[model samples]
Target: MQESVFCMVVSRTRLIQAIACFLSLYKTMDNFKVYILCVDEKCYEFLKKINFDKIVLVTISELNREDLLAIKASRKLNQYCWTLKPGFIKYILTLEESIKRVTYIDSDLFFYQNPNVIFENQPYDSVLLSSGEVFLPMYSKEVNNTIQSLTGNFNSGFISFKKDIDGLSCVNWWDKMCVDSCTSNPEDNKFGDQKYLDDMPFLFNNVYEITTQGVNIGHWNSSKYKFTVLNDTIMVNNNKLIFYHFSGFRIISKYDIRQVHEQDRVNTPFIYQIYRRALEKIINDVEKIDPDFKGYFTVDAVDDN
Candidate 1:
């Protein structure tokens, strides 16, 4: 009956992220347990004060051999690896052996409000996939065709899985996909792990699609939803925004765009404002905590934008 959110990020982003997660949790401290699955032991010390049990440290090598083999077998040139994603999935599946249901979250996300309502109202299932079905162009035509051939849809990033049979089926399918991605069709920089989940619904029962913006309101190129702030609450297309995906996050670069040309397009002023605000808040908090926080940006090369 407890709600959970999981995030994976490097140690450098820990300070900025700690502030964001804490700000989001301040309002729902009693309702949700915020878990940051860290790969660095040093980062755990920085997160120690937030909530001990809430912050879990996991080495990246924690992803076992079978999973590693599956990903390596599916590797492509310069493509964002899908194998890393399966590693997280493996971690999530283990939770099923311990708990009922949990929400899997990326570290580069911000929650403007509590999201326990999603778990409270939505029926429990083996897995949850966020359908950008109505949200974007589905990106790659070839990938879409491949997914349709498999009788599934494309999604990653934000997912909810029930700890029962359906979730296991999804995990098993992902295990296979890591080795046999349908879009490994010799097309360079095409579909990576993003669309491979399209096959899960056809393979598993109780596999549901969550259409709410509250869960995954990605602020990247997909602008199916708009952001609005009212009375101090951030709303996505009229619904109060629960979480926002800072999808293009990286350490020094600040934004990480993988394999998409249009992603390099300058972020709209509105979107820039959103990130600037979040980053500003993070800087302020970091300075208050550590005056000598040597976290300011210093670029070796500059973006023309």
Candidate 2:
């Protein structure tokens, strides 16, 4: 089988979730390779010890971009992470001759099956993206509808591309936009790196969107899917779930995580807790590393002071 590389940006702020993301991916798939842009020194140091042969750890300082370093000071945490996506993906592909393709995925995603099942069947000559559940009638809330209307029916949580001319053209265009100005503002026709993808199919050649319903099930649209556990496997719409994006899952207290974005996520599915345990285990690991590790901002553990 052929091998491929994947990239994601991670930080000490979301260190535990990053751990769960890595462990889950390794457990679920054996085909794809991984490279992470460690957002800080501590995260990079911690990941180096895990030492899986398929894993390569990269750091922001190592990327040596003084410009991004400057931009970091002006952006909020979410804005900062989103802005780096395109430039970082392009940087990763250019860093190695053997790296011919790279897929960008979020660090909060947990896998239920081999992601290679998606990659192996990918239209290799094209740049690939997936649509969000925002289009579903079950997700007919005003907020979901508004965001979908602005962002153009796509989610940037998972995007893949080849290293050829067409892919590089997309990389250059996307990197320019993110680096120029990336923000949460949707009025300007850009909601960080994801919305910029809306223009991709029109501007670049061989762009493909994933239409398979079960691939990127996440908190935003997961409530629309019917999930059942048979023989210890979680099936959504009778298909094996590929991965679930735990986008807004946050630690509200020492031992509590809440789905802040989805108001009705209380009884969503048992699959939720399965990924939860993976994240909580990694949190426990971090606590052992330091009895006072304040690694909770986005996965924001409330200040127990």
Candidate 3:
């Protein structure tokens, strides 16, 4: 049997992103399942209705952790998802034995090529992370590189690990770190849950960075690479565009999408429109199930403050 590979993601306000992420994976990839830890009961109930066979929905009640329960008091609303990542992976591993590997990808990820590019090429007993670089245009060199230099050179958008002694140990260590001090503040070598990933190479054996160029393209590195979509094939620097992390994509309205990719300067890729359309389609479909369903993007909140 093919190795039971899985992908885990968290969705609170960005329910459409998580839905779009799984839809893209199910449509593009051949193997594996995507597990979602809906950050609230509402998100969970909505996902349950869609009932995608390959997608499994998890909730906080299932996790049964006092640690996660305490997060609400200390962490802000947005930081909650980042904090749940490591613990979510640990939860899946414990629930299922056949899952030999798990790749935690951001809910905003949309794919055009097989994710197998990472797993098929992975050597025995190795942990995998994608490099947060390709080549940067001169315009992006200063700020982008400065942050990369400080926060480690890898993007935690997509992380993969094989089931083994070392892999579990690494995930556990990361879980502990996030629970204790995961923050957006990059102080004392901390910047969200991401900076901790900087140590993966020095801390573990057979840790490999992805050679797949199109795996995690976003604004930070997108400025450096050329993206061309020919007859439905999106290529990045002469390789198949595996996945594009639509990190800061915003729905200004149903017809408009604001592409704010991190703090990087980018000549927006055509993939943005394609991804936006997909999310729009999901929102429409989901709203049909429950007309009252409102996404963070769809709702317009007045700034009363």
Cα RMSD for candidates in order: 5.8, 3.1, 3.1
Candidate 2: misplaced stretches above 4 Å? 135-144, 298-305
Q: Report clash pairs, candidate 2.
A: none
Candidate 3 TM-score to native:
0.90
- Evaluate residue 15 in candidate 1 and report its C-alpha lDDT on the 0 to 100 scale: 50
Question: lDDT per residue, candidate 2, 1-305, as tens digits?
Answer: 23368898987767777778788887887666788888877778777866666777887877778878899989877778887888788888788888888899888788888876675676565688877647335544797778687766678889888888999899889888888887776767777777888889999998888755578777666767889977888889878888888877776444777666665545767877777777777777777866677666643332210
Q: How far is candidate 1 from the true structure (C-alpha RMSD, Å)?
A: 5.8
All candidates' TM-scores?
0.68, 0.90, 0.90
For model 3, the superposed segments whose C-alpha errors exceed 4 Å read: 134-140, 252-256, 262-266, 297-305
- Residue 76 miss distance in model 1 (angstroms): 10
Clash pairs, candidate 1, are 125-162, 126-162, 126-167, 127-161, 128-160, 152-198, 153-198
lDDT, residue 18, candidate 3: 82
- Pick out the ten consecutive residues of candidate 3 with the lowest summed lDDT: 296-305
Tens digit per residue, CA lDDT, model 1, 1-305: 34355544434433564456556656555545544544445455556643445556555556555545444444432122344555565566575445556566655556767766666566665677875443235457676455444433544656666667777667766756655553534243335555566667887888777745566655333456666778987766778877666654433423422212234555432544565566666766656765665532234311211
Instruction: Report the candidate with higher TM-score, 1 versus 2.
Output: 2
Among all candidates shown, the one with the greatest lDDT: 2
For candidate 3, the per-residue lDDT at 289 reads 89
